[model samples]
Target chain A: MPLPRRLVLTAALAFPALARARDTIPPEARPVPARLLPVPGTVSPELQRLIAAPYPVGWNVTPTDAAGWRQVQVASSAAIEPHMAALAASLRVRVEPSSIAGVPVFIVTPETLPAANRDRLLLHLHGGGYVLYPGLVGVGEAMLMASHGGFSCVSVDYRMPPDHPFPAALNDAIAVWRALTAERDPRRMAIFGSSAGGGLTLATLLRARQDDLPFPAAIAPGTPWCDLTDAGDSLRANAYVDNVLVAPTGWLGGAARLYAAERDLADPLISPIFGDFTGFPPAILTSGTRDLLLSDTVRAHRKLRRAGVTAALQVFEGQSHAQFISPGVPETAEAFGEIAGFLGRHLA
Target chain B: MPLPRRLVLTAALAFPALARARDTIPPEARPVPARLLPVPGTVSPELQRLIAAPYPVGWNVTPTDAAGWRQVQVASSAAIEPHMAALAASLRVRVEPSSIAGVPVFIVTPETLPAANRDRLLLHLHGGGYVLYPGLVGVGEAMLMASHGGFSCVSVDYRMPPDHPFPAALNDAIAVWRALTAERDPRRMAIFGSSAGGGLTLATLLRARQDDLPFPAAIAPGTPWCDLTDAGDSLRANAYVDNVLVAPTGWLGGAARLYAAERDLADPLISPIFGDFTGFPPAILTSGTRDLLLSDTVRAHRKLRRAGVTAALQVFEGQSHAQFISPGVPETAEAFGEIAGFLGRHLA
Candidate 1:
């Protein structure tokens, strides 16, 4: 056949695929590379919507004092409690408030035990940038564990920054653990959490070992903020690219500073990544590619491997900063399901 | 009540939580961080086994010269065709050889006719650093589109280095498009590929525009080898952390050099990221944090948007080069399905 003519369709439609004809497409026609677009025909319409769902921009207005921080916590808790209740109810779990050694806690228990592992327990810590969520919003991870792992769960209502700060949350966790261990077999239990809760989970283990408390059967720290110091590579490499936690120097940095106050950030309790991890119980870690803590999680996994601990990491695609919390997202179920499955095999 | 001991069992657990004897747990007993552990009592005995499943390490003994590269291609093609055949049968797609304008291609068509839109086509380019994965091995990406997207697919079995380097692949794609566009509506067609295929898919769009051909409706370039010059950040940031394509300075770099021959890598046809995306069709990009070309893919998406193209990005966690191609991965299905969905809406 004779060579087909060039420039026919491009010239006809004036499609801007031509760089040499830069003037063809106007500047305003260009849109910001929005994080995720709801493109049709690629995935199911429902998934397209889900993938394109925007994360609430969590811009922290640094609270100057305890009262201001308390106000922030109250407002956040009120908005999230209802959602947590709905999630728990859907998972067929009951939420009841109680006190352990005078510290308030939320108890999450399945309505009916599976007749086999009724005595097993999981302690959960919720993630909210260390100062955001309190009370019920802090129980999402606990609810998942109780609902899916066939174990009763409890979450500590830990004191947070701008008020109690560093040692407070850690102390609260220690107290609750001390109370639980009074009767519960540590070997039959597991502790897990996400975000700040994830960091707290690692710190709790360190403190527990320091106090000579028995180790839990296993732990799942979902994208643990192990290095509160922002020493991870992704902190710079993924800045702005990770729409969530856009910059560690902003809210994430603020939260870390507020929590640490006069304390050393490198303190193992604050940044567990620097802590001693040998002989630690088997651990499972989870995180997303866009999560600013991607390096933190990966580094933690690497450290765990170095320490010869049995660790399993389950990372989901297109996720950011605990995107697993959305009950509607399949990745959420996949993450929690994997955690439950890992816990099932590891828990005493 | 009396000041209770620090270690007490929860009334529910009835097991002891101990503290106070800090000396019992020696400091030396605790090591550094750990990795995925088989935590007892967490998951079923079976799932723990599944979660711990090891990836078959893909070790490539890359050939040094043109003839060696050709031999490697034959060996790899022979090894992978049976697997691809099994996958095609499962997807109910018939894969057979066809020629368009003297270019050899693989036609992958769904067995059943959908009531609507059966005339639409997806042109797939397969990936293998430029000189590898010839013949059926190059058709993996095409298979995914045909199976999941319900589209009649055709993969360009483009020429590679050692025999037909550089513009051979791009030219072959252009020739095929020219022939196909003679009979088919350009807007009814879409193109995609991964790695080298991803790069070629992009170059095809650039060259097609240069030839002034009508634009395809959409394209999905998965973890594209956009910058053949190794300019992207992840190439360094990810380094050995990415087990696949471990170091670009090694085989990946070698392949790029061979493919380009004497051409400038900055040439839009070689590294399409440098191309002006002014009027390109709406596009979707996919990659993972662990993929060394992650920056390449991300940067390309950014450029397309800056050039005024409608583009979407989906990043996976803990994945390597085109890790989404695993036949058993739900993420693979999810990724391909989304691409098909996007094309469906954009295609005529």
Candidate 2:
């Protein structure tokens, strides 16, 4: 195998020849920048450390501490809130200062107020594999909620894993709910998230039931990681084809492990896939075919239906994971429209 | 377990409310029909008998050949000249006629195309569950191919199944290659199909590899029934979520069995996922998340990528089988555009 110098030369020659034959612009010839600059935001020291840490690989280095994890979690969250705030400002929406059960919160409301507004609320959870939190990701959706569905949105900056593993984020989510229900009408609120946030949204519902809290009117989990066990066929099926995230063993599965370190991967409270969904609020699930978590969404929908809860599942063909976050893409707009319409029908 | 009166009344009230909530405006509310009406075409007596026969609950039966199952071996083919006559009248472009082992072939190029004009051919195979020759469905995709890709296409009215089961469609696809190579080139073709045709698009590539024909530039097997053995998880996963075609033992799986008959379900030729794809072309596969064959598309992409073929799988976020054929939906346009871009990169 090592002695094929002529063959190697032939292969090298073929690369350019093939490119010419295909008439493709070489990567170097493309005009766009090779790197996407990180959005401007204040980086908290804890967040800086978390982001700088090499993502865990294989099944080692399981850090289990709620306090340590919370520092990284909050710092990372604090770093990105300004970008989200900036995006909200660009959308001309005002972010109202608020507190949910003593947890500092921001409510994004549209510039043009609609009178006689029904008390519909969209509680959004940002996704970062349960480790990183990018608050800027949901501006488009939040704006869509305000303008299209006529609902105010409260995005939770929940605690993260490792330091806040297992039930910490779930507890924070519930705390927000406990506080929101004290003032907002329970029948008019909805929970929504993408990726880990999506998982948290489902887990929140399970926790709400266990804690005897008021249930939101509806829930929309977009490409949720409902099963932390990596039991979904897509985990094996879509390992490489999905390009948005790192490989599973290093990224998604790693994050899930850190998030569920002390908890059983199949625990309903941690994963939600194993939860009893009998009395859960109506749900609207969205995912794409190419999404690695497509099976999670599908299985969750099936579980909800089997449990006799009304669930609507909408899949976008040829889409990657969290495609709904791609602001200008038609699928994103269409997905948001569908979510708003669904929330309007159920919560309003 | 006779229902109590109170339970029955409760159920009665719940049923109508559920039905009303589930029911969107009927297809009639829209200008176009929800399902494509079969275009009127001349049918042979044998085909008429087959069409008139009741389809079994779990079987996909079509009026193709009256003869029982038999292996079809292709020895030669006749050329069908590019019919400029039809193109002029229909605002289509007639590609030159060529032959695969002397099988006459023609390509119908679309006019007033959508976006790109280079390096993409929606290599459509007409459906009759591998039994009937391509007809109405061929025309359907042709219209879409022309309007969507803004490129030329060739519809392989491949030979049917049972009388010409496994290899005939494959042979026709090869003939399409022979024809294209004889006239144009192989670097600008993308295979596409629906139902049985979708299965053939997949199966054809498996055959193309065996025959050493140039692989298609790319492939889009829409709602393909790749698991002829009915082994995919979606057979049960999408049983009720899918509305257009019945599931599990319905039209798709039944057609697969009838066409495949006693063939090994894992035979890669019958089910491309089983085939070794060392040299297959890049592909863009599509399916509705709700389609029973959604897993088929997922499995194919996974396998293709595992074998190192570049693949982009697109699942329409929320749709039934072959939703792209519906036309005018933003999803259809998006899917077609992605396929075009993929083809352009690979085929150009």
Candidate 3:
């Protein structure tokens, strides 16, 4: 008889883990190139630090992190509160938890809001590879949008994998969105996220529309992992070079499997890159050359543009996936500023 | 009988010239990715003016500027004196012509040299795709190094193609290196260049060591065009994305042919990537992500490191080839500052 699916996967992965080098080699530390040097005055030390920052090889290993991610998820939600408090220095925003139609979310609001955007709201989703960021780690991006964007923000602390997987997160997001639309004009709201949250932001929209809810005014899915299937060029081309999402077929892929289980990975609600974006709100996405999902971001932007949706792609230099989280990281600052500016054009 | 070599090359190149779009794309405005959006603080209005600074497309077409490059070369050498005068405002350094052991060179000394590095000198070479940068344009990098690095610089207006090509530029660089080493102890000097100058810097060392001359303390080949043959991945991957050298198969490639002529393309002198870098001095190379020659810089740095040479590769974000010339470009400022710091480590 054919082996069971999980057993087959475990057996296949066991060989690689046993055979592959136990140590990891950072991309920056990876030796050497062709060609002439570039024009002078272009290579800055900041870009150098951003690109050449070294980490242990296999830093993005899925299986290695799978247990940790699940453990964090299983760990008391209160443990992440301090991590959320630490994010205050970078964002300078007020954060407090509240129920959105019974869905728990943190409301993030800047000290002051612009006169034009005083009434507008930003809905944010946090990235954690669909398996991590159990609590306020999920609100890091929301804080950025709230503080940098000068708007009231709501970060969905939606249900997640292991205990709550697949459509649970989607159901929570749609419910919160429905509750949001009940009290506020959808056109005055902008939704955004990065990484897994980025993919969920898009998935939420597909579900929101299916539930007959209206779209938000704009979206900034910063480096969205839109394709759960990992079909983008950078997934392979940038493999080890992008230290964050090291390889397409590794733990991150396995995490997707754990969340997706019986769900078709290609479902428009799962991988939004394959969705029809016609009539969707204008989008502004972000990525970097070293982002393993760079192709996902680029292809999604292209897909949106091809469908006649207004889309803008903002890519940073030398950054890996969700590099925006690094405190005082210049690229992250730029990402937030541009997203806000883009929102200024479309939102209230 | 085979047609005369020149006639055959002309026939082969003419068809593509007559076929291409003929629209030169200013590096920033290339159609591949659009909008005037730049990194927020980094992309100031002035720098924006400098980079997104548009120009006639098809400027890289050889036929369009063949006359211009040659005419500038053929014009009275005195014409460059005025250009040098123009640069004095930017560099605040004295510029004048001098001969060292019968080899002509331009000396660039700063307003004041740092006491720690007062005795040190930087031998410089300018990049012109092995064809252009006929005059003071050759010393732009030298001026930056002088003004920012605080080291007296000697820029080799090395012989280039269409008039002087191949071994001519290499010979000139080597002669200058020898003449300089005779005056300044090689230990207190560093050699540097970008593009063709970058490649020539490497070739100069090869030639100098072959002739038993001592090596400089270190070398900085910024975005050096180390390979004449198009074997690197970036030449194809970044073809149109890098507006400076739009396609390796076009005028840039044609220019290499013009320089190489009958020279074996794979000779270590022509493509230094194939050369043995064992016992080479420590190197610091620069390139940008969008630079078509990025692979070249990465490969060379790796080769040198593998050969036990200390090699540091610095790359910038969003920049095309040679973006350092644009005034007030923050990346340029950082490049010069870091090079000066790198020089301070080894030069004195």
Best by lDDT: 1
The native-contact fraction of candidate 2 is 0.01
Model 1 Cα lDDT, one tens digit per residue, B249-277 = 55567678889999998899999888888
What shift in Å separates residue B304 of candidate 3 from its native position after superposition? 1.2
* TM-score (0 to 1) for chain B of model 2: 0.68
Write one digit per residue (lDDT tens) for candidate 3, span A93-112.
88888889789998888877
Q: Which regions in candidate 2 have their CA more than 4 angstroms from the true location?
A: A1-86, A113-117, A134-144, B1-348
Candidate 2 per-residue C-alpha lDDT over A156-191 given as tens digits, one digit per residue, 9 for 90 to 100? 767665666777788888899888888888888899
What's the C-alpha lDDT at position A299 in model 2?
Answer: 68
Q: B162-239, model 3: which lDDT tens digit per residue? A: 767688888888888887788779999999988777888888878877899999999999877888887655664455
- What TM-scores do the predictions have? 0.51, 0.47, 0.50
In the range B1-348, model 2's lDDT, one tens digit per residue, is 121121111010001121122234221110111221121112222222221222112232222333322211110000111222442345354444444455444466665654555545566775434643233224445545565667677676566655566666677777776666656667766777765666778778777777767776777776676667766545444443344443554434545666666777678777766667677787777776545577667667656655667665556534445655543344456566656656677765
